[model samples]
Target: MTAVALVLLAADFVTKQIALTHFSGSDPTEALGGLLRFTLVFNSGGAFSIGEGEAWFFTTVKIVVVVAMLVVSPRIRTPVWAVSFGLVIAGAAGNLVDRLFRAPSPLQGRVVDWIQLPHWPVFNLADCGVVCGSALVMWASMRGIRLNGTRESDAPAEAGATERTAEGRDR
Candidate 1:
């Protein structure tokens, strides 16, 4: 899972580089049949350019988020959790590349978003990784699955406590 995550991250970085150099044009170029486009737009804010021009702040926030995820990710053990963390790692690393490189230097770098849906905001591979990974984690959690890698059942303690209480009542 770590290997897969790193590979995905590397792929995201490489693809972004290509976009920066090749597709990072002054205009948005159609990559697929309108479903995809190689648009060269720089975002200095949050997802979908919510806070454009705030490069420094956003970069700092991103770094913090990535670092936090990296630190907490290793504790995740289940296969699904591992995959989810990997995807998140890929996304973080991908965007981190942009924050580290690109024009204007340092934390002032802009994110490269290209893939665009007809009705959705333009996004990139990294963004996809983030969204999918986050969703996986959320779904797993809702189903009572642990994201911390622990294999213990979620209801074990509750059930045990209930049994103990019933025994006390009987006594």
Candidate 2:
């Protein structure tokens, strides 16, 4: 989980740096023939560009999320949970760094977003990590997979059955 998070964080950082350097002050760069484009943008907001100019609030939320993940790390027994948490933590931390150290001011810095998809908001790798991680978590929950590696069995056991009744004879 740590390794995966680190790799994802690095990818987010590097890609943001590339976008900042290459796409700023230029027209959007199309790739995959308009299926994807790189459009440099600075967002002081939350997901899908909402909460614009709420950098401080978003930063605080990111901090809370990272801290919460750290506090719950010891309880992450299953690999799926670990991956989900790792991705979320990494993505939060990735944006948190921008909020802390990027331009404008501390806690007021804008996040660098560049990737654009058809009929979708412009986003970055961190967004991808967060979205994918959230999807995995939702999927696990729907599949009855618990964080402690237990699954809720579909087969129902006979409730209120006495030992004699369970022995194939009526009590």
Candidate 3:
């Protein structure tokens, strides 16, 4: 999981650097005709540029998320949970880097977003990682999968090991 997170963070960092170097002074570069393009944008807000001046608030949120994930990661008992959380943390950290040091000022730096799609908001690799990771977490929870690698159906039997009977003895 740590490896996955590191890889994702590295990838996002490299790609953003490339975008900054190559696309910063140019018009939109089309990757696919009328479908995909790379257009440099410095966003100071949330998704789709909402709340465009709230960089400090967003930075605070990212810090909380990263710290919470770090605190919880050691207890992750399943590969699935690890991967899901890793991706999320990687995504958060990627953008957090920008918010902390990229431009403007500390906790107010703008995120560099470039990838664009037809009729969709411009976004970047970090956003992709965050959305995909969150979806996986939601799917796992919906299917009654626990973070400890146990299904809900199996929990009763597992709990029996620690359960006590009315006689005050382990079942």
Candidate 3 lDDT over residue span 1-171, tens digit each: 798789899999999999988885268888767688898999999889988999999999999998998998887898888988989999999999999998899999999899999999888999888888899899989888887788898765655554455446633
Off by over 4 Å in 2: 154-171
Residue-by-residue lDDT tens digits, candidate 2, 33-74: 899899999998999889999999999999998898889878
Q: Candidates' TM-scores?
A: 0.82, 0.88, 0.88
Residue-by-residue lDDT tens digits, candidate 1, 55-121: 7887777678778878887677688888888888788778877877876788888888776777777
Arrange candidates, best TM-score first.
3, 2, 1
Steric clash pairs (candidate 2)? none
Candidate 3 deviant stretches above 4 angstroms: 157-171
Q: Which pairs clash in the backbone of model 1?
A: 77-149
Which residue pairs collide in model 3, if any?
Answer: none
Mind sharing the TM-score for model 3?
Answer: 0.88
